[model samples]
Target: MTRTLVDPHSVPAELRPYLQELVHRTHSVCGPHLVSVIAVGSVALGDYRHGRSDTDVTVVVDGALPGRALPGLATALAHPALPCPAAGLELVVYDEDFAARPSGAAGYLLDLNSGPSLPGKVSLDPAQSSAFWYVIDRSVAHQAGRVLYGSPAREVIAEPARADVLAALRASVREHSTGAGHLADNRVLNGCRSVQFCRTGRWQAKRRAAQAVAASEERFRPLVNAALRSYERPSRTAAAALPTADVRAFLAWVAERVDETAV
Candidate 1:
């Protein structure tokens, strides 16, 4: 049986109030520093898992942000009153590095359309193409997160439908499973299979993989393990490589823990 997990509210007493405060703090300090604020992830979707989720917020400055604001920003996040005590925060200062990327922000780029005046903006166009799609593809591929804060993330970008998710997955699979004798990266491969494909070519592949996932979890586990392990390796070239031994061993350990509570 799948183990029961605690509800998010039960796990974090101050989370809601903290987030509210964050909205205020951001608007204030960011007046000069930020032209826009975009909230992303499950939090924005309103389906955040208490202990499992971290806040994914994008603060877009007028120009590039100076180094001075980092501390103030950190304080706003780690303020003792909030839920979960700011375990971590991803502050993506969108500038040239972001602008040059193929798949901007992440793989599943949820653009925010918060409306005029507060016409919030954080562009994901920078990431519409490259390896970054792997991240975006996975988020939307899962259940739709609740809209905890901010407007609809889907409206800002040119998603054109669900084609973006399919495209990202296709790119991910090709990168991880390319070439003969190459060990296919399983974790990512599984993700590619998990998401629905909007395009005709990818739709067929998605269907085939979906059938395979349903038929055999055991067969898929190894691939998942391999990809998860190798996902963080330093990229030397474009080749699909296996993960380090430490990664493999760590995954094995996790498997043991999961099996321990098996129904």
Candidate 2:
């Protein structure tokens, strides 16, 4: 049986107009170079919350955009004139050639995270560069991503190798596990999702993954519950409520399990 895909309109009503405008502005900026614009992550999974989730987008271009075009696109996306409703906009721009055959190395043309904190500011961080993010995003996009422009996501994105996905998850967990705030939440939840993927060969949103893990392993229930609670009601106090030591132990345990199954 053919599976039904999540509708792009499943994104929160308050955020839909902003996403539409983002696509229109991107099309205008990239012009003929534009290949596709896709929405991935929670939004694509139909698990997005208006104030907590981010609008994760991947813009595919025909070729590497000119240096001048990079700043122009950034300015256009984070311009004070175009406001976003969610926590922020996490967007990455990729070249079609590279996306079609990713090298498993850091080579994304542009990585942007913009929000209301700095309405007119668009900070570009090379430190945020990771082939893992691209690879994982590609896999998610292929499976459940919503196409906002150009071709269907499956037509434009290649399926990431299982080994590659595991590697990316490992790297992600390691990198984000060091912090106590939002990173802690990300590490715990994403680690659970990674463990779920390793066991089931299926990707799930963090909340669902946490629920699955809790259901399967009684010992992990408390940690998963904490993460889910924090995810649902994100705040400084909620983040602080998480048991840091338990989160660390969970990460280590999940990482070991993932490594044991690595091909």
Candidate 3:
């Protein structure tokens, strides 16, 4: 069940062929019920950290497939190189209704912001938008990384949401000042930690080692700052939470931050 992690480049070189084969194989068995198979996660984003990453894939099947046939596909994904044994493979079958409003579409939260897909491409959905936003708000603000898939693979996800993303990004930078035990505990901090950890094992380890420096005082300060910062002036970059009044308020708050920083 344990497979060695493939670097982003190697993943596509190795996994893509297998995935294409899997798609064809699924088509043969399930008939024309299969739609597309997409790859998500670090591999999709291109900013994959070599060793500490796993391939996240989405198998888009046609609605015609019977419920019973799915377990078989799950069983099929488990190989030495692509070890999606049992629970590892998350098979999501989309009906025509769901397909149109894919929550994991190219512009969805994380995927919109990720790098390039190593092997295959995945779609996104908008209903699950909140979760994606939550992850980005916490992760990007705190970490350093890139997207590998969806959108224009070469175009960075950072551009669309730069101002707000930077706001969170700046917050994460400040989070590192305090001793936050693990990056995941803080969204953006975790993203930053993941990027650092992926690149040089020792570098993140070194960064983690310094976590004890500011400890409680630093941690409390950042959290308080984020709360106060986001309170009066919440971000408008959140597509779900934007309106004319909210946008105006958010912009005013952003201006205040710039003014204060300039002073």
lDDT tens string, model 3, 186-248?
Answer: 332233333333233212322242242224235333432332233223222211222333323
Weakest ten-residue segment in model 1 by summed lDDT = 1-10
Report, for all candidates in order, the number of backbone clashes.
Answer: 19, 0, 44
Tell how far residue 54 is off in model 1, in angstroms. 2.1
Go through the candidates in order and give each one's C-alpha lDDT: 0.39, 0.75, 0.35
Best by lDDT: 2
For model 2, residues 40-94, the per-residue Cα lDDT tens digits are 9888777786667777898888875665687789888873556877777888887
Model 2 ranges with Cα > 4 A deviation = 1-8, 79-81, 117-128, 234-240
TM-score of each: 0.41, 0.88, 0.37
Provide the lDDT at 181 for model 2: 34
Residue 231 local lDDT, model 3: 25
Among all windows of ten consecutive residues in candidate 2, which has the lowest summed lDDT?
A: 1-10
The prediction achieving the highest TM-score against the true structure is: 2
Model 3, residue 244: C-alpha shift (Å): 39
Better of 2 and 3 by lDDT: 2
- Candidate 1 residues lying further than 4 Å off, grouped into runs, are 1-14, 64-67, 79-88, 95-194, 197-263
